[model samples]
Target: MSHPSMDDMNLNAPHSMGTTIIGVTYDGGVVLGADSRTSTGVYVANRCSDKITQLTDNVYVCRSGSAADSQVVSDYVRHFLHQHTIQLGQPATVKVAANLIRLLSYGNKNMLQTGLIVGGWDKYEGGKIYGVPLGGTVIEAPFAIGGSGSSYLYGFFDQAWREGMTKDEAEKLVVKAVSLAIARDGASGGVVRTVVINSEGVKRNFYAGDTLPLWHEELEPQNSLLDILAAGGDGPAPMNE
Candidate 1:
């Protein structure tokens, strides 16, 4: 059998999607983070895409995989959860929403190719994190992550993740994990964006790329590439809003 070439691979699977998204459950609530850069294969598609979305006043969802698929599934879950809450006068919990996604994906034969983590605080559950990947499998874990950027996470998360962390500790851990992932993953860059779900409700925050430590700031270029292209261009600076 002949192996496929890069050209064939790109042609046969013409979509490019990249991201780093994580969800963590701590003592009081759940924390979620996602990178802002949207990529298609090796090319950057958008620099300002928000992978973490508000599902409700207390619930948040982070998506990774095909942008279109993630968008549609997340929207569907959001709408479904919203209507369910309004109808019953009760907010949905992280597990409820995760299982809902699992149901929808299973019915669709898990065609979306998306990995999602639903995080939130529920009056009944306090704090929770749910992971759903392709195939409708729903996992209730203390922490969960997804995307190509996850390739760099094996050892990183094992060391960084811990239970009973305070809100502050969880937030900083999120920042560190995302920062390291961005530094190493060529397809995952741009500023790190996050959402925190607690009793106060879901709140979003961000870390501009410039605000993060430049791991390569001390490396001297063998010759110079910055001098050849755009003299002063640092190439894709972080955006502020």
Candidate 2:
């Protein structure tokens, strides 16, 4: 009987570091999304890793760059947030979470390896989106994005994104931006995963070209820009996103 080496196991692990993550604060809430592709060099590592993750019932994070680094830091920040809630008798806010991420990656920013979009609703601040980029820089923006696919977002956002968008409208914009990236960027593929934060709290969603977007089963990308545009500019499905 032969056994796989550690490198082989590592290669098989699901940590799609190469991705596109977007966060936007709309009229009364926030929406965050990511493509589910993890790649290493020329090979795709995993397609099903959840890049957009729940932090508090109200706060969530979208990760890009160094998969292991982001995952571990987010886990640490999660624990800290929970502990804060326990000690303070209230849930942690987006600002607090963003600060923690900043502190963790600060000073070591050059060596540290991740960029994050922290989005959530707060009692005092209302809907918020904070960017904790590499080098410990914390930027609060109405809309922000990161990762390999972010470069493709500039034009679409410049043309399509606007202020005071409703949640449904925000979702459409996110899906459209990600679809365009997946079509052009080889590093980003797989199903698009999303999370929304509002007065009611967090809403999680999944988007794809097919009704069932299962990465492990399909082992390939579902829709390209051409695939979506070819199907038509608008469709009843998430393809129109």
Candidate 2 lDDT trough over 10 residues, lowest sum = 212-221
Candidate 2 Cα misplacement greater than 4 A, ranges: 1-16, 211-241
In order, the Cα lDDT scores of the candidates are 0.80, 0.83
Model 1, 43-63: lDDT tens digits are: 566766888988777888888
Task: In model 2, state the lDDT of residue 23.
Answer: 95
- Judged by whole-model lDDT over C-alpha atoms, candidate 2 comes out at 0.83
What residue pairs are clashing in model 2? 16-38, 175-241, 176-241
lDDT of 2 by residue, 1-241 (tens): 8887767656655454777899988999999988888886556777667899788889999988888889888899999999999999998888999999889889568776899999999888989999987788899999998888888788778888889999999987888788777777778887888898998878889886454333323444345565568877763456543
The window of 10 residues in a row where model 1 has the poorest summed lDDT is 218-227
* Model 1: CA > 4 A from native: 1-15, 216-241
